[model samples]
Target: MQRTADRLLREPLDCYDDGAIEEGDLSVIRLALEQFHHAVADRRAVIGTGSTDIPPMQARQT
Candidate 1:
């Protein structure tokens, strides 16, 4: 999960804010995502699960 996050940060993804996201803001987003995923993993680890099935984050195109 961490690897995927890192790759995503390195790749070019869209910013829904149009032009609101600046160069400096990327690090902040990256750090936040890292922390969030780490926390999720930690929480899942405590639950004695063989694997964690994280749901995909997608928006409905209705």
Candidate 2:
């Protein structure tokens, strides 16, 4: 999950630097934000499951 988050963060930066994503693209930003949220959720889930806190992956946005 941490690896996924790291990848999500890296992918956006890479795309921006490669000119694949425009600076003013809100869609791209939203997608990146969503991916980041997912990664965080996954990490939290892993921790929660390990410690038996809230049954794991129960934390969600919206």
Candidate 1 clashing pairs, residues 3+ apart or interchain? none
Candidate whose lDDT is highest: 1
* CA lDDT, every model vs. true structure: 0.60, 0.59
Candidate 1 per-residue lDDT over residues 1-62, each given as its tens digit: 76877577644335524554565666676566757666776788898765555545443232
TM agreement with the true structure for every prediction: 0.48, 0.40
Model 1 TM-score is 0.48
Which regions of candidate 1 are displaced past 4 Å?
Answer: 1-17, 50-62
Cα lDDT of model 2 by residue, 1-62, tens digit: 64865676667666767888776753665566666566666777887844323322332222
